[model samples]
Target: MDNPVGMDNKPIARTNFGSNFKIIPTNDQIKELQTVIRDRSTSRSDFVFNADRLIRLVVEEGLNSLPYGDMDIITPTGETYNGLKFLKGNCGVSIVRSGEAMEQGLRDCCRSIRIGKILIQSDEDTHEARVLYAKFPEDIADRKVLLMYPIMSTGNTVIKAIKVLKDHHVKESNIILLNLFCTPSAVSMVTKAFPLMIVHTTEVHPVAPNHFGQKYFGTD
Candidate 1:
């Protein structure tokens, strides 16, 4: 019955994105979000609503990590001061269906944001993420890509997403891996493969073994 007001309190960490990945929420809040999403007894409606709320918080927190510039401002008292403005070199792209589920959250927090869509699905046998669809703006290379995936299990989907983004000429530092739930192995796999890529996840669960000994999760 809690209002989900503290989802943005989850802790964050530094990966490959330099100072560009700074939204760090807390571990406690991350766990809370995961618990709500994973609870079998929760109604589908509640699940979707709560998950959306959490995703909004995540998006807002992520926005805070973006690079900013200083602007001159005059106060009501006639004093001059420097104010921070959001750096405008980034774009957001969500993995279809589940990833798109977070799109409204991103829109609510950003002004004049451009959203791209990619479809990646998990192979039932291999548990790998295969890209079924992708479409991006021609100017994507000039903007940071907020690659969104709702869950990070084996990291295959996100990896493929990154590959797509890179093929379009987007720099590694310009790609941020954003997810709702992630496993330690998933984070490690992506970071080890792409050191310059930064990741922002709500929570990291311990490893869960797949049929082929690979850590995996069920994605609908």
Candidate 2:
């Protein structure tokens, strides 16, 4: 981890940790994915296939951090072994449109995972977003939530989403922001705003012109 200067002229570690924000990707993995995605010659289909695989890997990585307790188990060779169990069930919520692309991977990785939806649109004038629709199970407060939104170039939408979850009593630590792409500025924004929420992004670009930049491989 490295330190960046802040308004107070003090050193700040470059990671976000709080009740709701956590970043999941390492610099190496993110760079590899970015190289593949940025290749103009890459076929759209192939690009998507690889992206989906990468997303699955990220989901699995995040799951490994959840609370787990060891239990005695017998191996196939009749040897004693230890295993872990999920402390609680989890929920997956997508930020609509592009987020839908990630649902399949999350579903495939988690058994009978509950899916939630949040629809947010940006205002043409203020550049702020309004949540047009949202529906999450009443039990979401108790479950670990996986929030998905692709290409987080700007932190506005995701920040609003976190606020909504908090208002509903969901702890920031229980929320994980899953995505395929993000910018350094956006990462800094979310990490600074909601340090506890883990962010699992496949790639980090320098800074995108808009929330959805031209090079971003997303469904606008």
lDDT of each: 0.69, 0.71
Each candidate's number of clashing pairs is: 7, 16
- The C-alpha local distance difference test score for the whole of candidate 2 amounts to 0.71
Give a tens-digit lDDT track for model 1, residues 110-138: 86889899887778899877888889887
- Residues 1-220 of candidate 2 have per-residue lDDT tens digits of 3233343546545554333333453567655665566666766666676667777877776676567777889998999987887777688898876777778888887768888999889877786978888899898889888888777867788988888888888998888888766666777788888877887755455543243332335432
For each candidate in turn, the TM-score is 0.78, 0.79
The CA root-mean-square deviation of candidate 1, after full C-alpha superposition on the true structure, stands at: 6.9
- C-alpha lDDT of candidate 1 relative to the true structure: 0.69
